[model samples]
Target: MRWAPPGFGGKRRSPEEIKREGWREQKVLVVSETDPRLTWPERELVRQLGDKLYGYRKEARHGRLDP
Candidate 1:
């Protein structure tokens, strides 16, 4: 799976479009540590990536690096 920053693809849809497509809004960021398809090394990589993204997101939101 690929991850991208929110709203990169296009503008917001109208209510009619949303209903027609059955779109649902939810939290955007997700880190899964238990994906069975990932090999041991890949899982480790994902964990590290998740850590980095989380830290960066925290810093961006709070204007300071995580301790």
Candidate 2:
């Protein structure tokens, strides 16, 4: 079962809950390999959000949230 790292904001989410929510494997790429157009703040936001963003993406893909 998967679990969110401790201190994730919002209601606590267990790994099993995340899987049920349709979270999938994600490949991590070096920042330079990511979109060159992304600004520093955008990159920082992505770093800060991390897996939470993945969860959001999963939720969106599953229709749990509006795109």
TM-score top scorer = 1
Worst 10 residues of 1 by lDDT: 23-32
In lDDT terms, how accurate is model 2?
0.55
In model 1, where do residues sit more than 4 Å from their true spots?
Answer: 1-31, 56-67
- Which lDDT values do the candidates have, in the order given? 0.62, 0.55
The true-versus-predicted C-alpha distance at residue 52 of model 2, in Å, is 5.3
Cα TM-score of candidate 1: 0.35
Local accuracy of candidate 1 as per-residue lDDT tens digits, 1-67: 7776998765778865655455345424343566786788888887678767564444344665565
Root mean square deviation (Cα) for candidate 1: 14.8
Per-model TM values vs. the true structure: 0.35, 0.26
Where is the poorest 10-residue window by lDDT in model 2? 24-33
lDDT score, residue 64, model 1? 56
Q: On residues 3-63, what C-alpha lDDT tens digit does candidate 2 reach at each position?
A: 7776875587875565545534543343421456788888767654754544454533564
